[model samples]
Target chain A: MWDGILTGLTTAVMPFNLLMVVVGCFAGTFIGMLPGLGPISAVALMIPITYGLDPASGIILMAGVYYGAVFGGSTSSILINAPGCASTVVTAFDGYPMAQQNKAGKALALAAYSSFTGGTIGAIILLFAAPALASVSLSFQSGDYFALMLLGLTAVAAFSGKGQVIKALLMTVFGLMIATVGTDITSGTTRFTFGSVDLIDGVSFLLLAMATFALTEVVMTVMRGQHNEQEPEMDMAALGSMKLSREEVKEVAPTIGRSSVFGFIVGVLPGAGATIASFLAYGLERNLASAKEKLKFGKGALRGLAAPESANNAASTGSFVPLLTLGIPGSGTTAIMLGALIAYGIQPGPRLFMDNPDVFWSVIISMYIGNLVLLILNLPLIPYISRLLAIPRPILIPLILFFSITGVYLVSFNTFDIQMMVLITVIAIFLKLLEFPMAPMLLGFILGGIMEKNLGRALTMTDGSFSFLWDRPLTLTITLIAVFVLLFPLLSAMIGKARTRGAEVAVNEGEG
Target chain B: MSITKDHIGGLVFLCLSVAYGYYAGQIPLLPGDEYEPFNAQSLPSALAIIGGVLSIALLVTADRSVEGRLKLAGYDFWLVAKLLLLVSLFAMALPWMGFTLSTILFLVGGYWLLGVRSIKTLLVASVPFAVVLWFLLSQLLDIYLAPGRFFTLMLGV
Candidate 1:
């Protein structure tokens, strides 16, 4: 283990590798600052570039981008009301208020430190834990894979909520169906290609993700227009000099430690990404803080501001564990990374770590470097980024649209992809109008293909017995866990609603 | 706004999935002696069945639910339609107009639709960004770009 750590550290110290980390962090920061363009998009745009590099170098660069983007997102959320993406929404609860209260620099500094701390700790845990988990997974058969996919799917309920649970389930099933389009791996049958030569290979999830998440986002931005109002320039000089007093640090220390653990566990679960983790952490923090302290949550309470920022950064690192060791991508960005690995002729599975330890460990080590880079950059750059709000909404929308369109087209140079983008964007708009969660849609798209492949393999191996799913203890346990997760929201909602029956109904009717 | 539209979309997707399952049935499978008996068509067909069942379920529930009856407002439809039109246009023009020109036009149209009325703000904000992207995507990264005929002809490289 020490040798592996030393190997990882040594690999990351190479001049070229260090340069890639710097570049990745710089690009990640810019991409995260832009609304609707998350770490996923940044990674997607960079995937093609990585095609030419060594596998270890490519993976490290992408990891840098992922960690760097989370750092960048916190700055925008703190300096302005804009969150850049869902993960930072909790940050905005206190971050924007900090800006308003004239402590933008201090808030930014604290956010940088907390994020660095959370992220580094998360990376260390991932480095130590992933290998042990991967070794256990080496014994996994088709049954285990099938059960794991089921576990991933059941996370929809835990993540999406009761009102939209059914829709999220159906959407996931639809994604699985869509995954069947193209030549089958075992049978070599042409499935849903629809006679289009382009689709014989199947719809690229990268293309689909870009269309669904990025392009659709552009359309929404256009519809919503710019909502941010320019504020007085945050005094850049005073920000750097401001320091966290010992008492103030004492108050937030517990919050940070609790949120870090919370975020790490949340990230361990499939489909539960940084956004949900951060939101859950903030909610927990709110419940724990004193009433006198609680009132300060939205008004720039240091703990409130720090909790989500730390949790989300930790969550981002945590999300990578399953993707690297299990070959199961927990989020859209990791899905794209998996695609990148596949394109390089590397299968991301339990064997991947044993087969290519340098690639796996180097990427892990690079994350440590990425977090440090983000901390250094964000601390001094908050005021510079805050000034960007002065750019009118009218002008910013067009530039955003341009990037969205150009980025997608450049991916495959396919015109048909653009048409698909339009179709998906339309569906996204309707989904948003109804307040449906987009994360589930993303999770569905990412996991859809893998679930189908494993399920197919499992059924074939079992010779038609549905009992195979129940035969294994580990598999059965996972399925039971999934069942419990699916039913959790319904059970909680019913009990909560029952208690407030009369008053809740009155309020509901009044709102309607 | 019509519950009918949602139901119709579901129905259409279901039928299409069934057709896809039939197509998957025709794809060649690996020889039975090598591994498992079930081949390519089985998984897809299973998914199709699940999709079909859920779609029907959604249609039925939507038919009964009053909330599904709400129609999209006029402005919503217009916004969606315009977005579709612009995306299709950008996709088609990309190979011909090049990334920069197509990006500029799309941005202008998008900003206008989104309520950015100032021409000056649009140009000033969009141009520099487009040039920077061109440099990053095309030059620094060495990504193969589909240059416009005009640019290619003018450069004569």
Candidate 2:
């Protein structure tokens, strides 16, 4: 482990890789500040650029972007009430109120400091947690892997918000259906080409990600007539002192610490990402607060701003745990990273720690450096970064659209790919209107091929029987867990219905 | 019953699953391959079944509130349709006009569609950005971006 850490340190400190981290942070910050684009879209936009680099540098750049986007999202949430992503929505509950109170500068500073501490704590935990988890996962067999993947898919659907579980599951199935479009590797036969040559290779991950996230998100903004809306005018002069008083610091200290740890645990859960963590952290802090403090939560209490700011950043780092260890993405952003790593011909899993120690360790090391860059560099430049948001929406919209389209086009240089992107973007827009979750579909798509491969191997070993699922105790445990996760939401919903019916019946009896 | 977004979504997916299952059956298997545990048709068949079941479950338990209905009003669907058409046109133009020219045209068209009518704003935004991007790909990266078919036919170079 020490040797691997040293190896990672060497690779991370290399001048070019360091440069990539800085550039990725800046780019991610800019993109993430834009309304309607989140870390997923920001990272997706970087895919074409990363393809030109080595796997280690590519992943390092992406890691920088991931947290940078999260940080940037907080910035937008504070300055304007328009959150750049869902995770930062909780930030706006108090952050915007602080901005309104002419303490925008102080709010921004507190956010950056909390985020820095949260991210550093997360990275420290990841340092110990990742390798240990990776070593344990090394024992995973084909049956175990199949079970793990099943758990991943089910957890994503179950965690999808109220009334969306069935929708999420159907979307997952849709993603799996899309995954079967190309040639079957085992048999070398085309399944859904419909006689088109472009369909022969199946859909490219880059195209799907770019289309679903980058292009569709930008187009959604235009569809809502946001393109015509005036750019937010920042009152730079009104931003007050950026420093936190000693009392303020002491007040938020425990809140930050608790939220950071809480956020990390939530983030490590597959499919529960920064968005949920930040909301939960804020709620937990509010619940724990005394009456007077609780009253100040929505009105810009220092602890109110601090809790979510720390949590989301910590959760961003924590999401990488499952991605780096079990090869299962903990969120939509990590799911895109999983796809990128696969594109690089590097399968990220337990083997990744041993097979590509530099890629593994360097990414971990760069994450710490990336957080430092956000604090030391990006925090001070928040005012200037917010100015980039002033670019006319009409002009900026086209440029982003151009990038999302050209990003995919440059890879294959295939005109058909561009057409395919438009088609997928249309489908994505339709799905978004129905309020279906996009992340689970993406996660399902990413894990589909691997899950199928593992299932096939396990089945063959068990002579066409499904008994391999239960033959190994480890596999059985994982399978049972998947079943429970899948059924938990349904069971809870049923119980709630029954309770409501009983209440209504008792009320009627009393009235009679 | 009045239809909601969930009802439409469920119906669409149910039809999709049925079609997918039909195609899964059409996937040809190698000789004696069916005897094996898994084949090309295995996952697809299972997915279709699961998809259909989930779609039915969604329809059965869908939210019936008025808020659940799909609202199309107030959306700029016309502008969105035009923008999508422009994207399709850009793809069609790529082989004919090449990367740089097509990019410039796309940006100009996008700006125009989004209500940027100033010729200077349009030109300034599109031209330099397109040329710089093209130069970065072709010169700095040494990528061979083809001159358009139109240029090839006309210039014979």
Candidate 3:
């Protein structure tokens, strides 16, 4: 473990990898300041540019972007009360108040410190926990893999949003269907290519990712008109020293600590990314703080800013856990990362830690370095980052479109893939207009191939018997957990709705 | 006019599921696979069946609260259509115009189409961006950005 860490640390320090971290952090922060672009889009957009990079370099860039985007969210939240993403909504809860009180610099400082603490602690946990989990997962077989993948799919579908469960699952199934294109691996026969030699190799992962994420995003941005983002009104006078007094640090220390742990735990859960973690952290702090301190929440409480900032950054790190160890993506960003791994022909699972230690360790070490760079660069540099918001939407959109085309083209120099990407993007936009969740579709697409491979293998081992699903204890246990997780929310929602209907009937009867 | 997005979406998925299931049956599978109970077509067929069920469920309980129309006659509608047109044009022209020229034209035309009026913004955003990216992708990364068959024939490079 120590050797891996050292290896990762050394790889992370190499000039090119270090440079990617800096560039990724800067770009992420700058882009995150935009009202419309969040970390997911930011990471997605960069995929084209990172296409030429090695896995370690790409992961470093991803880590930097994750941290920078989270911090950058604070900038918009604090300055304009418009968070770049939903996860930063809680940052605005107290951050804006602090700015209003002319303590903008103080708020920014606390946010930076708390983010660093959360991120660093999260990285530390990841360093130890990821490998341990990977080793434990060495026991995973075809059945276990199938169950885990199901659990991943279920968890994301269950929690992605309210009233979107069926839609999410349908999309997931559709993705699985899409994965069936081209030659069937085991059979060595064509499936869905329809006589097009272009698709005999199946659809490119880059094309699907670019289509669903980047291209769909471009269409939406153009159609929605401008975000009409308001100019950030940073209290320039309050942009003074970003120093934290001893008492101030002492006061928020416990809140940061608690939030970091809570955030890390929440982050590890599929579908519950930074937003939930931050909100939970803030709620926890509010509940535990003394009456006076509690009153300061959503007003100008330092702990208020500290808690969410820590949790969000911590949660971002925690989100990487499943993607690295299980080959299961927990969120849209991680799903894209999962796609990246597949593109590099490196299947990310338990074996990744053992087989591709350099890629795994380098990424892990880069996380530690990336967050450190963010902390160092955030303070005194935020005002400059805010300047990026002034870039017109029209200009940025076209440039992004250009990059999307170029990026997709780089993977395969053919024009057919580009054309397919555009067509898929249009379809994706229509789906989005109908309120479909894109994340699950992308996740399903990536996992569908893996799931089918494992499902077939598991059944094969059992001689075409479905009973093997239950004959294996661990697989059965995992599948049962998936079932419970899926049904629990649905059942609760149904019960709650029925009770509400019953109450309404009773009230009308009484009136009659 | 009273139809909602969910209604339309549900209908589309219902039809799509049937089509997908039919297509899955058309894909040939390996004969005599002793190692596995299922073939490549098995998972896709199962997915289509499950999708059909979900689509029916959606169609039955479809929400009508949200408005469904894209307002085809409206400005926003045209904006989307125009963007699509520009994208299609770029894709169609890529082989003739080459990566550099087509990208520049696409960005320029896209900006103008999207209503960016500032000439300076358009030029700075489109022309230089295309050139820099040409070098970055072609020169630095050694990605083969087609110089267009027309350009190749003309320049004989």
Candidate 4:
């Protein structure tokens, strides 16, 4: 472990890798501040750029972008009340109120401090947690891997929010269907090419990610006529003192500490990313608060702003845990990272720890550096960075669209991919209108081929029987967990309906 | 019953699954491959059935509230359609006009579609950005971006 840490340190400190981190942070911050684009889209946009570099530097750059984007999301949420992403939506509940109170500078400072502490704490925990988990996961077999993928897919569906579980599952199915489009790697036979040469290779991960996230998100903004809306007017002169008072510091310290740990735990759970963590952490803080403090939650209580800012950053770091250890993404952003790592010919799992220690360790080390960069550099640059948001929508929109389209085109150099991107973007837009979640579909697509491979191996080992799913205790346990996760939402929904019906019947009886 | 977004989505997916299942059957297998545990058809077949079942479940338990209905009003669908068409056109133009010229035209068209009528704003935004990007790819990175078929034919270089 010590040797691994040293190896990671050496790679992370290399001048070019360090430069990549800085550039990724700046780029991610700029993209993430744009409304309708989140860390997912921001990271997706970086996929093309990363393809030109080594795996270690590419991942390091992406890690930096992930943290920067989350921080940038908080900035937009605080300043304009238009959250750059869903995770930072909780930040606006009190952050915008603080901005309105002429304490935008102070709010931004506290957010930075809390985020810095949260991310550092999460990083420290991840240092110990990732290696331990990775070592344990090294024992995982094909059956176990199949079960784990099952759990991943089902967990994503279960956590997709109210009334969206079935929709998410169907989307996951859709993703798996899309995954089967190209030649079957095992048999070397074409499946769904429909006589088109482009279909033989299946869909490119870069194209799907860029189309579904980057292009679709930007087009959605235009569809909503947001392209014509005036840019946010940030009054930098009105930003008050950027310092937190001694009392203010003491007040939020415990909240930050508590939420950081809480948020990290939630983040470590597969499919429960920063958005849920931040919301849960804020709710927990509010519930724990005294009546007077509770009353101040939505009105810009220092603790209110501190809780979510800390948790979301902490959760952002925590999401990397499953990605590094089990090769299962804990969030949509990490899912994209998983796809990128795969594109680099590096399979991220337990083997990644031994096979590519530099890639593994360097990414971990760069994450801490990323958080530090956000604090020491980004906080001071907020006023200037916010100014970039002033670029006319008509101009900015096309530039982003250009990047997203060109990002995929540069790779593969296929004109058909550009046409495919437009088609997928149209489909994505339709799905978004029906309120279907896109992340699960992406996660399913990413895990599909691996899951199929593992399942085939396990089935062959078991001599064409499904008994392997249950014969091995470890695989059985994982399979059972997957089943429970899949059914939990449905069971609860049924119970709720029954309870509602009972209440109505009792009311009718009393009235009679 | 009045249809909602959920109903439409469910119906679409159900149809998709049926078609997918039919195609899954059409995937040819190698000799004696079916005797094995799994093949190319297995996962797709399972997915199609699961997709169909889930679609049915969604239809059965869909949100029936008025708020769940698909509302198409107030959206700038015409502008969005034009923008998507422009993207398609850009793709078509790439092989003809090459990267730099196509990019410039795409940006100019996008700006215009978004209501930026100023020729100066359009030119300034598109030209330098496209040239710099092209230079970065072709010179700094040494990526061989083709000069388009027309250019190769005309210039004979």
Candidate 5:
């Protein structure tokens, strides 16, 4: 085992490998900085290019784009209050406010430092934990896979915030319904194509993703009218001059350490993703902080920003663990990447390690290098990238549209795809306007194919006994966990209501 | 803006799903002894039922009063309509123009419709982008992008 790891480490240290990591990180940062373009889109857009690369190098480049884009996303969120993706929304809550206060450099620094710390710690944990997790998951039956999908779907309810959960669940169901499009595996029958030749294979996840996340967002922003706000100039001089006190660093250090571990664990669980990991970390940190400290959160609390930043980065890093080891993607970005890997003829199961240790371990090793490069690049270069936000929305929006169209066409060379992109974008706009959450839809689109294949495979394995879900203890445990996750919100709500009623009764008794 | 529109939307989506599910259900099953009885149609049919129920739930839970209808007017329906139209046009023209010219047209018209102020800046910025795209996609990547029909006719493919 050590031999494989050491070999991977040694192979990854070559100059060409190092260059790929740097270039990947560089491109990821720029892509991440662009509005409506997150790591998922960046990776998807670049995956085709990586086809010619050796599997390890290809994976390394893609990994760079993934984590590097994440780091870059924080820049815009902190500087302009525009989150490039959903995971960075929390960062914007406090990050941009600090930037507004002329603490852009400081905010950027903290974000970078925290991201590095969290990412490195997460990588270490992933190095040790992913193999173990994969080994355990290797024994999972189809029922277990179904149970996992159920749990993943339930997260939409958990993380959809204080919004109308019925709406979120409705969207999730709608997403699952959409996922049902294309040929059904068991019957070899088509679903939902309506006689369109383009959809015999079902709605493309890539098309759906680009439409919902990227194009739909563009439409909404355009329809909302060009935002006229000038980009807040980060006081670059002030940014360089200010420093975190040793005492302040000490305070957040433990929080960062704890959140990193928490985030890594959450990320390793398929379907949890970065947003949940960050929120979970923040909730945990707030509970541990003093009352005064807690009050400071969300209102420029360093830990407020630090915890989520660390946790989200860790989660991002940890998500790759499952993708690399088990061939199961933990998030949308990784799923798209799995498609890319397949396109490159690198099958993504346990044999990935045995077939090509260089591919598996080199990609992991590149991540460590990518994070260091990103930290160094971000610490000094943030001010320059923040200028990108100043580009008029008119100019930026068009370019974005151009990129989306071109990127889509380059891969398929099919006009049918362009049509598909537009249709999906239009639908996505309507869904967004109706307050339907897009994340679950994205999750559905990515996971839908996987879910269908596994469902069929499991049924074939079990001869149609629905009890296959509970046949194995592991599958049963996953199902139970999913049940708990699904019920958690309702249970918590009931408890809160009871507590309120009890408080009122106690008050009445005291008055009497 | 009416509660009826919400109901109609839900009804339309649900009906579409059911119709889709029915069609998917019609595919011939493969010869297999060890498959789940649930075929392509099963999950989709289940989803259709789920969609139908949820739409009804949304309909029932919808606010019934006139004030509820008034709230819909505030949601900038014009913007959505324009976006839908633009996307349709882009999708239609993309095949004829290939990626570059088609994208330029879409972006230009989209930005103008969406509200960009300066044409000079738009062109200045957009042309170089077109050039770069040509070089990168056609030259470096070797993707055989379809030429514009008019251009193809003149240039002889």
Candidate 6:
């Protein structure tokens, strides 16, 4: 493991590789400043560009985007008073008030430091955890794999959004259906191509990815109208010194440490990305705060800024655990990367550790470098980002369109794909209007092929006996977990209602 | 309370599931194969069943709302429609008119449609972008972008 770490650190410092990391972080932060666009969209949209580079360089770029967007999201939350993404929503809770009070520099500095700590800690946990987890997963067979993939899809669906289970599931199944197009390898027959010559190859992953993210985003932007909601006026003069006082650093240090562990744990869970991690960390901190600190939390408490800023960065690193060790992407942003890996022909599973350790380790090491680059960018460059927020809608929207169309064209050079993308974009916009969670759909599509393959293999081994899902202990354990996860929300709701009823009854009896 | 878009969406999906299931059932099996009931058709057919049931549940249990229709007007509907139509048109025309010419036409029309009134900005942004994209992707990356009849005839290739 130490040797692996050393190799990764060495690979990450190469000039070209290092350059890609810096560029990705800068671009991620810049794009994350856009109001409606977030890290997932940033990664998905940039994938075509990455296709032109080597896998390690491409991953280094995406990692930079992931962390950059997280940090940049806070920048938007602090400067403009509008949270750019869900992960940074909590940063705005205290971050905005500080900006209003002219303590913007202090808040930004705290957030940056917390982010660095959280990111470093999370990477450490992943460094130790991933190899161990990968070693364990090396024993996973077809059945175990299928069950894990099943759990991954179900957990993502459940966690995607509340009360939208039906919609998310529908989109998920729809995604799988879309994957059913073109050839079914075992049968040597086409399944759902509808007889078009272009359809023979099924749909390209690039085409669907561009449609769901890039095109849909554009269409939604247009539908959102030219009248974007006005952001709070930002004052350049109010950005105080970009230095953290010794006391301020001392106060947030414990909070950062606590949230780093908390956030990394949440992040390691399938489907719980940085947003959930940050929220969990913040909530835990707030719950434990004394009367003095509690009062100051939403009013610009140092710990308030530290908790989420650190945790989100930590969780961002945590999210990589499943993607590298198990080939299952727990969230939409990671799913985009799974597609990138497949495009490069590097199968991302336990075998990848042994087969492609260099690719995995280099990406891991580049993230540490990316965070350092971000911290440097955060301090001096942060105050100036408010100027970027003033960019006009007309100019920015057209540029987004240019990237979407051209990116799609550059991939396959087929006009049919471009046309198909437009049609899918229309559907995507329709789904967005309906408030269907697109992440589950994306996850489902990525996993659909693999799930089918594993299912076929597992069933073949068992001679089509479904009960063999319980034959192996590992597979059975995974199956149980999947079932438990599906039922958890329902069971929790029932228990909560029951507790409320019991409390009311006890109160009535006492009054009588 | 009354029917919302969920009900409409659910019904749309239900219909699709039924049609997909029907089509999946039509997939012929291999001759003389002694395999279990599960085959190429099995999983898809099962998914179709699951989808159909879920769609029905969505329709039956859809939250109550006054039946509402999606309505768009003025700069809202037509501009979006035109932009959608414009992209579709450009996509279709790209093969015939070529990447360079088609992009120029599309951007000019697209910017105009999106209400970018500055012709100078449109020309500056679209022309330079199209040329550079063509050069970088085609020449540098060794990617093949089809040159349409217009370009071929004009260049006398």
Interface RMSD of every predicted model, in angstroms: 3.8, 0.7, 2.3, 0.7, 3.4, 2.3
Give the better candidate number (5 or 6) by DockQ: 6
Clashing pairs in 5: A182-A202
**Alpha-carbon deviation at A171 in model 1, angstroms:** 1.6
Q: Report how large a share of the reference interface contacts model 3 reproduces.
A: 0.75
TM-score of chain A of each: 0.89, 0.98, 0.94, 0.98, 0.88, 0.96
* Residue A322's lDDT in candidate 2: 91
What tens digits encode model 3's per-residue C-alpha lDDT throughout A87-148? 89999999999887778888888888898999989998988889998998889899989999
Q: Whose DockQ is higher: candidate 2's or candidate 6's?
A: 2
List candidate 5 stretches off by more than 4 Å.
A10-17, A34-55, A92-101, A163-166, A185-187, A227-229, A242-245, A291-299, A342-351, A501-512, B1-13, B28-36, B53-87, B98-100, B114-119, B154-157
Whichever of 2 and 3 has more DockQ, that candidate is 2
Query: Model 1: per-residue lDDT, tens digit, A114-229?
Result: 88878877887898888888888898887787777677776754676545665666677666766766766655657667688888887776666666666666566555533333
lDDT of 4 by residue, A1-512 (tens): 99999999999999999898888888788888888899999999999999999999999999989988988899999999989999999999999999999999999999999999999999999999999999999999999999999998999899889899999999999999999999999999999899999999999999999999999999999999899876577787888889999999999999999999999999988898999999999999999999988999999899999999999999999999999999999999999999999999999999999999999999999999988888888989988988998899999998899899889998988989999999999999999999999999999899999999998999899898999899988889999999999999999989999999999999999999
How far residue A470's Cα lies from its native spot in candidate 6, in Å, is 0.8
Q: Write the per-residue lDDT of candidate 6 for residues A436-472, one digit (tens) a residue.
A: 7788888888888889888988888877888768998
Candidate 2 lDDT over A334-437, as tens digits, reads 99999999999999999999999999999999999999999999988888888988899999988888888889888998989989999999999999999988
TM-score of each: 0.85, 0.99, 0.94, 0.99, 0.87, 0.95
Per-residue lDDT of candidate 2, residues B12-70 (tens digit): 99999999999999999999988888999999999999999999998998888889999
The DockQ for candidate 2, computed on C-alphas, is 0.89
Better of 2 and 5 by lDDT: 2
Off by over 4 Å in 3: A227-241, A290-295, A498-512, B33-36, B64-75, B118-121, B154-157
Q: Write model 1 residue lDDT over B1-157, tens digit each, in one string.
A: 3554456546655785677667656656656723564656666667667767766765665543556554555334566577669778877777778878977787777667666777886786667767887898779988877787667778864
Clashing pairs in model 3?
Answer: none
Off by over 4 Å in 4: A505-512
